[model samples]
Target chain A: MTGTAYVKKIRSGEARLWPSRRPPLTRLDIELTERCNNDCIHCSVNRPAGDREARAREWGAESWKKLLDEAAALGCLVVRLTGGEPLLRDDFGEIYIHARRLGLRVMIFTNAALMTPGLARLLKDMPPLEAVEVSVYGMKEHTYEAVTRTPGSFDAFRRGLGLLREHGVPFIVKGAVLPATRGEMDEFEAWAAGLPGAAGLPSYALLFDLRSRRDGRKNALISSLRTDADEFVRVSRRHGEEAVGEWRDFCARSGGGRGGRLFSCLPSGGSAAVDPYGRLQYCLGLRHPATVYDLAAGSLREAVTEFLPAVRDMRSAGPAYLERCGRCFLKGLCEQCPAKSWAEHGTLDTPVEYFCGIAHAQAVAAGLLEPGEKAWAVTDEAARTKRRR
Target chain B: MSDKIDLDRIYAPSEDIVVREIEGEIVIVPLVSGIGDMEDELFTLNETGRDIWNKIDGSRTVAAVIRELAEEYEAPAGLLEGDVAGLLEELLVRKMVVEKE
Candidate 1:
């Protein structure tokens, strides 16, 4: 009976061996809304802030709290409050305080454009449970407002930071280099370093991928902001050998043998996310309804027990998946996932060539793969899958 | 946790906190009441603080840690005592360290 027990490996210590079972769900990421005060060209998930028709179907505050209750009962310990801007919600305080009271540690992801004095005070008065991730677009107003496309957003951000400072609440400032903010790279890094919590926080984004939602007609804007595959990998190369070494270590303990499942990752087993309209999906970037468990119609328990098992047990089904993504041995390094695939092409199985190019470039640069080796091919696994098919 | 923690109180690190040594600094993450942040969820201890945190093995008293650090660094015992007391006070309030047997 114990011939082959599934093992869960943690960092720096012993790996816990478990019998094959449902993945333990510990964190819940609730996208409070898809609305944002900013209209950044690189954004993948924002609708216009005042688009009333778009928000008509969104769940109200009560529904959100009820979902939080359900999530808490599901053994979720931390609830990440994120969005186009989580601060855009008027009832954010009520929802945040409720989560805290329910014993859920709340982590807020915000743009700082709407962080008011009252909000900062409320957060500071409470015990420092987690970090507030404030997105910093540009150090200067002209550049910043260009990215946000809002006239007074920079002032709001400055005011928000001021409020946090006045109350002595520490936050981490992070940024992504879009076309509009690229020239301010040095200015951004220097400013981020000057922050109180800058020493141990993420301060930049590397390899910004294509729009996760594809945003239909709005894809043009995101693509315009996105650099080419070569440029993306060039930025990623800065991490150098550390990234390669980390990937090597990850694969060894990940339970993925030469021909293991493409996504034999703990994330699919251990975590789940809920989008704005009460649909429970596997991750923040995935919006596949067929794969989602509807929280509005069912309990989290049912979702975990029934829906997640099916999701976890999901196998590659098509010829394309078997050829490229399923058989790829760059398991740790590749960014190809169902979420990325779905976001790029509306299919779970198709490999996004752009991601492949980036992965191959990294592999070549890091000496993991030969410079001319096929980016989308794992020779041995490809042959194995071909025979099996 | 009183504003004045007794000098002789034996304290130990909380089981709820996860301490990891990353890139030289010791990072303490409160995992019991909250989820650790991917970017900034940890409270890192400086070299001195890490040494103190490591010596808190539930068997040692506050004064013991102070004496050990003072001797180890050849610093004044009186100064070390003040620093340790201040740090312990903050940690106690945050519930990262608690009085033990």
Candidate 2:
């Protein structure tokens, strides 16, 4: 072999590979564990870091590897390892390696509190095709620890982030909006912008969801920690005119109601999630007992092919939902989905009033609605015509 | 690096990379370090490159691959040898292709 031929370098966008035809499954979000080192004030799911009962209940390393194998065989190209913090698991490296060996790109979601030198070195050697997302509570010790509720967690997070930086492992930081960290938004944004590999603006979790396990006490704490509608709109607009313009354009293009169909917002097919305990659902948040399939009793193929589509096709028959959410054109603007509803109301169809208020506030701010105008009252024909034009 | 692509050497695609053909084009995704160049996470092959890549079966020597290409395509054996050697050199440097024992 002897001449100077060239290998064309390409970006991911330039390649028409992986799911060139939408395979039945392309992405799988695997919750490695529900445990976290930090007891964040607004977290929806977090078992104690040393909860042996929860640890005992989690599927073993081999079980997870089998699931990853099944997922890869089904044409899954990406597997996201997430949790209260995925790094808490002892065999995180083994599971991560298994997924990568199967040719599935791994994306980790962690609090960055548990990122060690060894883990960072492993990531550097075997890059996680997608960026590891780290959730940042605050920039200062007082504010950060206030949200995490763990003494010395701010320093741990910083030390972990430093290790990732030193080892050249690609990662991005995100923030949560709480009374504790609200004042530090500007600083957080500035720091994130300066960090290498941190793309665009850092996104914040403003409207917190209740626990998937439906812990009422924690749910109440989460509810109290959530930003008000006006505050959400104000904070969101701080991203500047370009972002607001993009939002307006998106609202115009997506203006419509889902009617009685509960899962119309979801993609037609090709995605599902599996919890740490081996229950598979259409998404991580849709933990409704009726919707989740027990993978312990069935295979991944059976769950995705037969069980998931049925759950996705579930319709809302609740009178309240039918009267409001079923007819609201701002459904596209709202974050009120079946999973959110289930987390908040213990039902798949009930409208979350907080989400409804936030959506309306956003709509009004985007100039899509009038003051005091309810979205459900706006006729679809009128809303469509107005938005489309 | 050019001297590394010996005519009698058999080369195979490295185990650290995943290769897939999409719409007739071959895309290579590097699984380990030193394979993908900085920020160029994906590498694609042109028609000529694909032809050469397909012939590197680990069982065939560089000379055999060039001879096979010469018979299939309307090119001189010397020119085909140059093309084969050039591609294998680049792949070798990037660790996308490794010399087999």
Candidate 3:
């Protein structure tokens, strides 16, 4: 009742309800592997070396195909293949081909270390060669390798990207700005722009709090190295001009509220995340049972339509749970959605303070909020205004 | 399958969401969240299906609706029934409405 009223009050300024008014999902994100050559400090799926077999038992290509088919049947137009490294799988080419043949645009997210001339040629031969995005950790060998924690990974990725370019395959570069790579943002952006097919030279920043693998010991290394709120704002403000004009425009228009960059409307439940093991999830970072759904043996559409209402109901009743986040103005800017809640607090709504701080910092950098504005004040005013109106 | 629907039972999405033609595909969005990122999995009704979906307001009986549709669209009633039935089944399954039967 409170959430319903809360949503109604906040959405009153607008002419219609949120989320329920948006289109349902037409995209699927496939995590091809948890195995990674590099043990990054902020990775969520960086399984221990000894747990390789156990992790492998979780999901595979066959399961992936079934999920992809279900997504396609539901009118999914694109599938972004990701993970520790999707290229580690020998059958990556086959899977890409299969999805493309089904009329779905397929994208790959990888470090590109394992990418070879052969794989490049295979992708170039395919007609639906959607852009390949590679994650560059840092500018130099020492800094980049330090973040990835893998020796020689930088050289491998560089060569791999070159192979893709020489073969005339479309690709772009994205970078994670850990403390090690923070200073190299400009260099990485310039290098990415110079790459073939990278006319726009787009890049991304990995929010510190979004490290799903926070439980891992190695993540601690990068966790401490993560960009702090005040400093993060300073860096963004300093380098904001480097972002492409369109991206900046998009960020400005849709960073929050009705016209922001949110993938789905909050609280109204327009979309959800289906995990690697076929469990329906409210967010990718959450591991709780309540937000999980079994999709192993049923119609995908039926499962979503039937089970989603319950999940939405539970999330709607989360004020008793998500106290800190429920009142935060940075809910839109922060990546602390239901999945992130599960990862950090093992609940659907609990707030991870780190994300809250990061969002405020980013907002200040983007000039969405004053530099000294307290997050609580903003949330309180918004809440008070909603109650009064 | 009944071709007519009861408009009273069908709940239309609120006015803030616009369902429009985008290059051939129907693009539906909250009046607030414009065309979303293509990567976010926003689904839309295809053109042909969108045409049929607009008619299912749940006001007409299955038989009467089909007869009207047959004459208006100049298609055979039998052929229209199969497509209409399939579409209705999908719409019903989405919790867009409940069937009387």
Each candidate's B-chain TM-score, in sequence, is: 0.82, 0.91, 0.54
* DockQ ranking, best first: 2, 1, 3
lDDT of 3 by residue, A122-239 (tens): 7666533356878888889999888888889889988988888887777778778777887787888888777775676465665644445346455465467666777765655555
Q: DockQ, in order, for the candidates?
A: 0.04, 0.42, 0.03
Docking category for candidate 3?
incorrect
Question: What is the DockQ (computed on Cα atoms) for candidate 2?
Answer: 0.42
Native-to-model Cα distance after best TM-score fit, residue A292 in candidate 2, in Å? 1.1
Stronger candidate by DockQ (2 vs 3): 2
TM-score of candidate 2 relative to the true fold: 0.89
| Candidate 3 chain B minimal-lDDT segment of 10 residues | B31-40
Give per-residue CA lDDT, model 2, range B1-101, as digits (tens). 24767888899999998776544557677787667666336687766788899989788988888888988876789777667777887788788988899
lDDT of 1 by residue, A1-389 (tens): 01111111132211122224322455788888888999876777787899797578778889988877777666555678998788988999999877766655677888887878888878876533667878888888998888888899899999888887787776888888787787887677677778776773355665454556676666766656665666766555454556555544543333222232434544533667888888888788777766888887898778876887687667766777776665565666667777888888887767777777776776565555677787345445334323322
The list of candidate 2 runs beyond 4 A from truth reads A1-20, A380-389, B1-8, B20-27, B38-54, B66-93
Please identify which of the two predictions, 2 or 3, would achieve the higher lDDT against the true structure. Answer: 2
In order, the Cα lDDT scores of the candidates are 0.68, 0.82, 0.58
| Residue pairs of candidate 1 with colliding backbone atoms | none
Between prediction 1 and prediction 3, the one with superior TM-score is 1
Q: Write the per-residue lDDT of candidate 2 for residues A245-339, one digit (tens) a residue.
A: 55566666665667788986556446899999999998898899999999999999899888988888889889889989888877667898899
